[model samples]
Target: MQIAIDGPAGAGKSTIAKMIAADYGIIYLDTGAMYRCIAHRVLLQGDDFSDTEKIIKLAQEAEIRFEGEKVFCNGEDVTESIRTPLVSLHTSDVACIKEVRELLVAQQKKIAGDQSVIMDGRDIGSVVLPEAEYKFFLDADVTERAIRRKKELDAKGIEKELASIKQEIQQRDDNDRNRVEGPLVQVEDAIVVDTTGKSIDEVCAAIKKYIDEVRA
Candidate 1:
């Protein structure tokens, strides 16, 4: 059984997907991190982010491996490196490219094939795993999602202005929604979950309820 959770930035899809995967005793896949891993490599090489060809080469040539929650790129541990604010900002540009999406989406599908996995990303429901046994579209308003991002960064000691974070989030949304291939959109049968005012447990319960209904 595969579950695809689609959401914009900071909509809690990653957190919820990890939790749901743990509860259901399945592997969890974070497709966004795959792009971030490539971005981290590009940045490490001091390559320009807007150079789509370089980015695609880096993505295709780089060795990205996920061991449980840790991510390794090019045999180097980058689980923590890719989560930086710099990587977050640059990855959006890399991810919006058609070639990058095609390469990574193919790899994502291969990783989740024949596994009981819970995957989360902007295009999971619409592209990466459209035939997943269960699917969800998670969303929250901009301001609310920005606040959540601020809190997360603060916890990591990454000082960032809320306004700047909000602006970056908007830019990411625009880039993802307007991308030529596999743009972010809800799958037809996915249940939309507004996560603005919901607790983690509540969201998990709602998803569990949906899973139960689907399996019934």
Candidate 2:
């Protein structure tokens, strides 16, 4: 079985997807990191983020892999490097490119390859895994999502004003929703989970309940 979890930034898709995959003994794929890996490469080369052609080429040529929580790009461990704010901003831009999306989506699908997997990303349900046996769309209010993102950054010792982070997140939402290639959207068959004010375990349990019902 394949499970697809789609959500905007800081909506707990990654955390919940990891939990679900672990509990069910399946592989977990973080599709966002693939884009971030390409962004990281672009930044390393000092290439302009707006250079779509270069970004697409970088994405296609780069080798991306994930093992547990560690991410590797071109055989280099970039688990922490790709999470920088700069890469986060550029990731949205790279992900919006049509060629970049196509390249990464193909790679993501190849990694699943008949295995039971749980994948999470902005467009997983809508594009990458439309036929997934289980699909979920997680969401939270802007304020709540911002708070979650801030906490994550704080843990990494990356400090930014709450208002600034909130604005960036809102901008990301706009970009994801309006992107031409595989725009972020909640497909009709997906289970929409409003994660505002909910704990991670609560959200995981709710999704697991649905999965259990299906299995039953």
Candidate 3:
């Protein structure tokens, strides 16, 4: 079975994806993290986003691996390093590059083959796993999503204003939805779930109800 969850950031896609993967004993592939790995690599090599050649070469060479929830880039463990605010801000810059997306999408598809996998990202349903048995588009109000992102940064002791977070989320939406390759999209067949004003368990239960009925 394959489950594809696509959503803008901070819609609880990652958290809920982890839960669903655990419940089903399947692999939880964090596709966003793969992009973040390349972003983090570019940052280390000089924090240059305009250098598409360098970025593409890095993508071609990056060895991204997931052991449990940790992510490794090349030979180093970048699990927490890639989650820093700076890396988060630059991830989409690299993701929008067509070559980078193709490189990473191939890895994502290979990882999902012949396995019970739950993958979450901007374009999983539309590009990475169109044949997935179950697909969902999770969305929430922009302000609600920004508030969620603020709390996450706060927990990590990274102080960021709520307004700034909201602005970043908006920009990311524009980029993801407008990108030329592997753009973020909701397939017509995908089940749409608005997570606004809903608790994680509530959202999970609602999605599982649909999946369970079909399975039974």
Candidate 4:
């Protein structure tokens, strides 16, 4: 009963995933947060994102855990820590490393193997959960995505310019799509949902209806 949701940043992957998982009484795994946990670890040590060995070593020893909506790394709660803009910037660097992806992907597979899980990430459908019973690709206009991100940060009282946020998201898209290890891609069988002007509930309903119709 595993479900995979893949998408670029700010496409409402996490929010919608959590909703669907809750509706189905399944575990929702935020796979991007796993990579961000490793990035946060490296940033805590230094700003050398280019050091592949250091990043891989940090990843090798990392213990990422998910308890409901919170993320824990090495027994420490990093739910809020890993969501920082800084960690978001460096997450791609860690995710690009071959060894790091293998380690995290194995953990992701193991988690799914243990239960019926709903996982979301850039590469989940393509790599981590290729055999998932359901796969969805959510996408939206880049500007719309950036606006969503700005609202999130603003709600958190973290100020950031919209233009800069848009640029940062663009960079993330490029990196995610171009990365060699586990690139962001829409699998052929994945149901594509354009969320450019849709509300979260709208998208969720659309997905549920699609899945339910097929199952029926």
lDDT (Cα, tens digit) per residue for candidate 1, span 67-87: 988988888888888898888
Please give, for residues 15-95, the per-residue lDDT of candidate 3 as tens digits. Answer: 999998888899999999999999999999998899999999999999999999989988899999999888888999999
Candidate 1 segments exceeding 4 Å error: none
lDDT of 2 by residue, 7-38 (tens): 89989999999999889999999999898899
| Model 3 bad stretches (over 4 Å) | none
Q: For every model shown, what is its TM-score relative to the native structure?
A: 0.96, 0.98, 0.98, 0.98
**In model 3, which residue pairs have backbone atoms overlapping below 3 Å?**
none
Error of 1 at 171 (Å): 0.8
lDDT of candidate 3 at residue 185, scale 0 to 100: 94
Off by over 4 Å in 2: none
Task: List the pairs of residues colliding in candidate 2.
Answer: none
lDDT of 2: 0.91
Q: What is the C-alpha RMSD of each candidate to the true structure, in Å?
A: 1.1, 0.8, 0.7, 0.8
lDDT of each: 0.89, 0.91, 0.93, 0.93
